[model samples]
Target: MSQMVRRLNDEIESTANMCVRNGKVELLKKVAREFRVEQKSFLEHLEELEDHIYLCFLTINRSRRLVVRLGHTRSPKHQFTLQELNMFYPTSKRIEDPGGT
Candidate 1:
């Protein structure tokens, strides 16, 4: 009877240990899943930032080309007048009046 009781106690302790180990494994899996979600979100944000940077570069290049074209004027000191600059804007967006009047 004493031997049987000892065997039962040992079995109970072993079972408890297994339960604790399984709980730890489940906790680790949950942490790993959360980390993966955060990583995916960060990558998505990075892609959006890259796209915005690419668009900004395109805008800068376009501005540089326009400046180069304008810099080819025959006169070295030829400053662009408001009228000349207005020609570059669409009629709808052109400044109607520089002064309050």
Candidate 2:
């Protein structure tokens, strides 16, 4: 009877250990799946940011090209007055005379 009890206890302990190992494996699988999902999301955001950066670069290049073309077309003697420059880019704040003279 004592031998039988010992055998039963050994079986129970073995089963418990197996269950613990299986639980750990399942937990690891879940964590790995979540990591894959987060990595995919991060990669998607990175791709979008790359696209946006590419568009910004294209816009800057186009603007630079336009400036170069305009500079070539305009006569060297033709100077832009402050009023003419302001017509293209208006100041948000009025310029106040510091001297008050």
Candidate 3:
């Protein structure tokens, strides 16, 4: 299991590296379309990913790779504070409700 997860993480990091070479917003669009992930969903991952790569990590889903961030960002909402990505962004489970998972 650990081996599989490590491989999945590797794929994600590589994909993210390619995206970064492009622009964050542009890459966000590309990843969403290619991966079938929502735009906001991808953005939340970026929000979690720090400008630096220190926090980038990978996880495997089924046989696919997913890169996640270790850092947290402030919510540009009506206020600013440390926020979780899943909290502000919509996930596969709850589309767009911060309150839901």
Q: What are the per-model numbers of colliding residue pairs?
A: 0, 0, 0
Order of models, best lDDT first? 1, 2, 3
lDDT values of the candidates? 0.71, 0.65, 0.51
lDDT of 1 by residue, 1-101 (tens): 34655896698567656766787657556655786879788668767877897888887787677767888854788887667677556678876666855
Total clashes in model 1, counting residue pairs 3 or more apart in sequence or in different chains: 0
lDDT of 2 by residue, 4-84 (tens): 558966985676577677877575566557868798886687678778978888877876776677678779887754443
Task: Give the lDDT of residue 63 in candidate 1.
Answer: 66
At residue 80, candidate 1 shows an lDDT of: 77
- The lDDT of model 1 is 0.71
Mind giving the per-residue lDDT tens digits that candidate 3 earns over 56-75? Answer: 33222311321123332333
Residue pairs with backbone atoms closer than 3 Å in model 3 (clashes): none
Kindly indicate the candidate among 1 and 2 with the higher TM-score. Answer: 1
Error of 2 at 11 (Å): 48
Name the candidate that leads on TM-score: 1
